[model samples]
Target: MHDPRVLLDPATDAVRKLARRGYDLDLDALEKLFSRRTATVSATDDARAESNRAAKEVGAAAKRGEDVTAARERARELKARIGELEEQQRALAAELDEFLIGIPNLPSDELPDGSTDDDARLVDTWGEPPAFDFEPADHVDLGERMGILDLARGTKLSGPRFAVLRGAGARLERGLAQYLLETHTERHGYTEFSVPAIVNRPTMTGTGQLPKFEADLFRTGVADRELFLIPTAEVPITNLHAGETLRAEDLPFAYTGHTQCFRSEAGSYGKDTRGLIRQHQFAKVELVRFCLPEQAAEELEVLRGHAETVLRELELAYRVVTLAAGDTGFSARYTYDLEVWLPGQGRYREISSVSDFGTFQARRAGIRTKAKDGTKGFANTLNGSGLPIGRTLVAILEQHQRADGSVRVPEALVPYVRFERINPDGTTS
Candidate 1:
């Protein structure tokens, strides 16, 4: 959420910035809402003041031994008027809040202009795509042949877009999650957390996942309490400090968590349906940070590098791209998508997205920072998929597979999975 005053101020370029993201800011509508709220507030205050004055007049009239009937009647009328105005004030404030919450964050001015993924600006490319001596099999073929992935059974149990990893595939998924968590916590200086897979409404909204993207989420209920399956660990981990203020000395908080994420895949009916590329449930390790607003840009770079470290360690070929305004996430001012090369798909697929929300989430979540002088302001929030287990596993299988159908595990993962290769017979050796 944004400060309505700043967004409504004519002198600010909030509207123009929002336009870059394809969000048409209805300033007139917003301004009118703000005006109505302000007027209601002012009227409420005036009525309360009159009520107080009338009460005082009644007291004085009683002390002077006067009838005091008129004074009491005046007080009663004022009190009723104050109640009416206060109700209007509450309604208008809620109306204005809903309006502000619906607005997307303004895109960074330095972003490359575009409206789609094709217009994304390529920032860097890593190792070259591996050359194959034979036709490469996609993860679906490789996993099915090895009896590791069972999508047919997954659909039987749940529905389409669900997956069941067995044997080596399941082990690899666990190993990747451990590797990611250990790397981020031990080497990247992040505090590891075990967050809940189910969260409440405010927790989801704190990270900009509710109200706007509810259709893309899975919902549940416990008795009368409504709950949501977290789309990403970012939601629960980043909101760990929601509605709290931290000391300036602790200006930056890096949190890493592994969770089984769930998403409804609402609008994506037919895309990436063949494999784990798009799934209803997947394992992911998420990285979240909270820092002073001025530190956001630099922190974003550091966060992006941290995500890249996973690909580097896994020896996967990948590229970093600055997403166009139109392609950026709802709460992010700037984003860098790390796309890993997949030989099977013959293209790079987005494996992770590191985003800098620049206090957009902080304001909404009520995450604040307090300086030494006792000044307080919103803290900037940022997060990235340190690595998604499913996609990373897919890349590993496709990139390291031999013509004989055996898959070589990345050297780094050998220690965790206890083997260097997944044999064609579904045995690790």
Candidate 2:
């Protein structure tokens, strides 16, 4: 959420910047809401003052030994009026809050033009897509041939878009997750955390995943409690400091976590419906950071580099692209998506997204930074997928597979998996 003071100020260029994301922020309608709220607040204050005066008048009449019935009755009337005004004030406040929460973070003025992924600006590319003498098979065909992935069983158990990894495929997913967690925590200076896969409504909203994206979430509850399955570790990991204040000395905090993410993939019909490219549930290693507003720019690059480190270590060919305003996530002011080259798909697919949310998420989550002099302000937040395990596994299988149908493990992950390669027979060798 944004600061109401800045958003409501007529002089601010908020409307223009928000337009970059293709969002039409109705300043006139918002002004009316703001004016109404202000009037309601003023009325409440006036009624409170009048009630106080009425109480004093009744007290004086009682002290003078005069009949205080009418005075006391007037006081009671004032009390009732104040109650009505206060209720209005509360209702108006809630209305304003809901309106503000629906608005997305303002896109940075420096962002490239346009709103969709096709309009994103390409930053750089790394390595090269591998050459294959034989026609490259997609992850699904390769996994099935190796007797590792079972899609039919997955569908039978939970319907379409679900996958069951067996034998080497399951091991590969686990190995990839472990390798990513290790690389991030040990070398990237990130503190590893084990977070819950389930979070409450506030926790979900704290990261800007609620209300707007509820349709894409898996909601569950027992009795009267409302809970949601996290779509990514980013949701839980970034909210670790929600409603907390940290000293300026603790300027930047880096955290990493691995979690099983669930998504309804709402409205995504007939898209990547095959294989591990899109799934109802998948594992991912996430990275999150909190820093002073001034440090956000540098933090973004550093965080992106940490995610890139995983790809570099695994020798995966990938490219980085800066997302346009509309393509960026709700809480992110700017984003960099790392698309790994998949020879099987004959194109680059997103495997990680590094974003700098400025103070957008911090304001929503109530994470503040207290300066040495005692002044405080919201902290800036950023997060990225170090790598989504399913996609990474897909890239590995397709990129490193031999013409003979065996898949060679990347050198960096060999130690973790305790094998150099997975044979065509689904045996480790």
Best by lDDT: 1
Candidate 1 local lDDT, residue 277: 94
lDDT of 1 by residue, 128-168 (tens): 99999899999999999999999999999999999999999
Which parts of model 2 have CA positions greater than 4 angstroms off? 64-67
lDDT (0 to 1) per candidate: 0.92, 0.90
Alpha-carbon error at 392 in model 1, in Å?
0.4
Which residue pairs in model 2 clash with each other? none
What is the lDDT, from 0 to 100, of the residue 213 in candidate 1? 99
Per-residue alpha-carbon lDDT of model 2 for 172-238, expressed as tens digits? 8888888888888888888999999999999999999988999999999878999999999988888
What TM-score, to 2 decimals, does candidate 2 have?
Answer: 0.96
Candidate 1, pairs of clashing residues: none
